[model samples]
Target: MKNNDMLKNILVWVVVATILMTVFNHFSTQGQSATSRLDYSDFIDQVHQGQVSQVIIEGQTIRGVYGSGQSFTTYNPGDPGLMGDLLDNRVKITAKPPEQQSVLMQIFISWFPMLLLIGVWIFFMRSMGGGVGGKGGPMSFGKSKARMMTEDQNKVTLDDVAGADEAKQEVGEIVDFLKDPTKYQNLGGSIPRGVLMVGPPGTGKTLLAKAIAGEAKVPFFTISGSDFVEMFVGVGASRVRDMFEQAKAHAPCIIFIDEIDAVGRSRGSGMGGGNDEREQTLNQMLVEMDGFEGNEGIIVIAATNRADVLDPALLRPGRFDRQVTVGLPDIRGREQILKVHMRKVPLAEDVRPSYIARGTPGFSGADLANLVNEAALFAARENDKLVTQKHFEKAKDKILMGVERKSMVMKESERRMTAYHEAGHAIVGYLVPEHDPVYKVSIMPRGRALGVTMYLPEEDSYSYSKRKLESQLSSLYGGRLAEEIIYGEDAVTTGASNDIERATAIARNMVTKWGLSDNLGPLLYEEEDRGGFMGSSRNANVSGEVSKKIDEEIRNLIDRNYERARQILVDNHDKLEIMTECLMKYETIDKYQVDRIMAGEEPGAPKDWIEPDDSIPPAPEVKSSLEEASEKPKEDLIEKDMSNDEVKEPGEPKLH
Candidate 1:
């Protein structure tokens, strides 16, 4: 690399030297026409006496020939007296015509620009190739953009990553295989050519791949999916070939490609024609993974969030032989992740990773790291020596809801409405069986909501029962139902818009996807192979009449659940009013206070509640926009109990 840099510097100097020489030669001959220099006094006297035969002015120099055929030059000082004397003498004086350039100088000037351009082009070509006369022209475009690193240089290991235990276990076997291929080969087994990691964003997929590379003690090559393709045709294919070839040379190496959906998406479905650069790239990747090139010790690892859109050919048995899922961290996984992130943070005695993990049920590994960082930031803002449980709680809330917008002003009527809306949700969630417990309820404005109610499940739930799904749908409708009942339908604000959207989605999925409706009878009316909001899939093959019936059934499910929610609120009107009063008084309350208020008792403060020191002032409150009364659901449908094959994936609807 140093040699390449030195060569580039030399090329730059060469071009600079050429330009300087051309400039110097052009000005060198400017004064050659005059043979001698005259003193100012003598020149003035000669000019006054009219001894000069022919006087000419060229720019700042005055040149003239005397009657004896002698030419001399002197500086031209604009003296009116000299001009007047010259005009009075009228000694065949004339202004010197502009100098005509010699043919050699004219040619050099005309060609200088083209030569400079050529020099620049050569310099750029050399720089691209890493040295002069290197193999870096248009052909070099095919080189892969992967950054290669030896195992000794990689510091990442399974210990460095947290919250992705299952993914580590799956990829760890590959590391073992790489370390000693004979262990598996002795048993008449062959290692998989590739491993595909599927997960949501920020689930530590790439981190897991790095761990495998570290564990195996082999070369690691990393590249992004977008790096494989370019504007020109055939470049992507060439890059894939080059990458595989390099991987083969460093046998027992690991190649990791992140966000592989960019290039591995299904071909022939794009708006552009089938022969686009991306499709060609995908085809080349397929061939290189399992082609005749015999990649004995090469193991490819790829990570993508959108695994559904990948082509079947690329995911077949021989290509991506094994698939692993890295999902959101469960409670235990979250606790471990918290511990990993908390190593650098100074914590108070009250701070507990288990408590924070319990509160953050569905947080990803990256989210946990951010939570820790935010807690530290909150401590720094308050000039605290250590982060406490309260700081962590505040950080988690900030991550889920958003920074509290305390400065926004709210009308008295709006505050009351928000209070009632949140109270309604709390009442329904508390009363519903199999529903997650409401962790906290508050009317403070956050993000886009004027108020919010948070729920934290005791454990990670993989499946849901029909009763649980119905109860969840009812809870979702609580806020909107309260708005309609208390304010009258005409006076109801748009605060329930997000709630209505979520309720409609859950109801639709129950009917069309979960087949909970008796009318649908365990049938998937919607397309099972659907993409996310970023893209769409082909329409499901259903008759128009069947589609109409599906919509009708969906409405029926929503109406039934809506009535169920309204009745729940009606039966607990007194409890709703009490909770609303408590919310208005406190502006925030926890589950314990909520339970106490429901039991018709004035509750004492918790043992852990600490009073702020008198020397420190409290933060001021800011009003913000209307917030939803419920936390946003991660998935639209409640398919907790169903297996992957039995349940249809629902496209995410509008977030509430």
Candidate 2:
């Protein structure tokens, strides 16, 4: 209580001191004014005392007295107590300088000018810092404004991005001008008004635009396709106007709109209420880009995966002059990309970039980075000093397939069946000339598969042989046959659900698309559209009689392949026994292990396998009467581009 009172007392004294000083300053100023102001009463009193002084009249000096020139007889001085007042009444008038001009009057006028200067100084300082944007003025919004990277700000020359070499050549001419504009102008060669970058996501479209900005050495204004759009009706158009205005001010600038198809899509064609907004925005962009009558130095660079949907106006000649394609790194390109990413990691001594490149067929720059990171993680887990080839192998498999799941439990009986199932696939792939070679085989669960057989075509194959296709079908049936011949047909389940679907589709396509049938008369049964109902949905005529012929041929082919699989399994009963035995023991076997078993060399089988008892009945020849399964001409196997090629680099995988 005492402390609070003492604080209150100190505050009160401070307030009193402030008020007292303010009152003293006001009184002092008043006294100064009063002393300097013209004092008629003082002059009258002086005249009353007979102190002589001549006051100026309209054009002459007057003696201030009752009868002096231009003097008033009755004059009572108004009280100017704090402002030049005197208590005298007499006739006195003055137009000339007073005889008693004081020193206070001169000093007071000199300091009054500084008082006015201080008030103006405070007002201007406050206005400059006045947070008028609800946030702040330009001073406070420094960081909020987007950074403008001129051509000189970046270091990624066109040479940095390796895969899109073709695109670089096209956009380079624009860069030439930004470097030296006079060279092109002298030759009468016009600059590209716009460049549209088209490619799948992560193909480096945006990066290419950055290169353009870097080369031109001009102001680069970058925004998204959706940036122009707003909830309001005219907002998008307004933003387009504003953006172009900014660009014109900074002429010879590059404006990059990433994913331009967002608002520039064929408007009024979409099922929405924003046609007014979209059409307005796109039209405004067109006018701004092409400029009604004047040539513009503002170059537009846009990017989109869906170039097909862009507005026709936006894609017109003057708008987006050239379209650049940034595609995925092909094999040789992938190798180069791998080389770039490889430089960042502490690679193991034996890890060759070429071998890694070969193993990672279709990796993008991002995928290569991930591969390195995965290798690093594998190394760190085992406390290895470097990223070993073994770690890379594991990483590659993990990336293509997924992490191995040894702990995913399966019954011993089920496990034996899965091993045989995968073994059949490995053996068929190895024997078939058209199919890819088996890379690895494992009974370890990954995703939903109880087992997986990994294979990759040795080279990127574009076409398949019919003989190869027939071999693959036989392999596809091997698992079921192995189950049936041993477990008496009841052992088969729905595990080959995926395999059946794929085989059926291929057979149908062979008949309908490939024209691969004898009785079907080499006629395609169906026609699928390539683009927009194959560009036109005109009627394609085919007689009903011809359709029946195709169906009969397809049935005949399926029956023939089924019979072939049964016969092979029967004759190779001994080989089947070796495979199942190995499967029961190890729960897995690679191509080398399967080959060893076929060559009569005992595989390094697991200890826990229950060996087949010697008393089991042998499998008989499938074609006991008819004979000769090998003599028939088989359809070729189709090898797909199934390299880790489709497994894109890790990022927001662009659906485009």
Candidate that would win on TM-score: 1
lDDT of 1 by residue, 373-426 (tens): 999999999999999998998899899877788998876568778888898888
lDDT of 1 at 58: 74
Q: Which ten residues in a row have the lowest lDDT in candidate 1?
A: 629-638
Collision count of model 2? 11
True-vs-predicted CA distance for residue 211, candidate 1, Å: 1.1
lDDT of 1 at 383: 98
Q: Over 4 Å off in model 2, which ranges?
A: 1-153, 215-219, 272-276, 291-295, 463-481, 508-656
Question: Candidate 2 — worst ten consecutive residues by lDDT sum?
Answer: 629-638
lDDT tens digits by residue: candidate 2, 413-432:
56666766766666555555
Residue 537 C-alpha lDDT in model 2: 28
How many residue pairs collide in each prediction? 14, 11
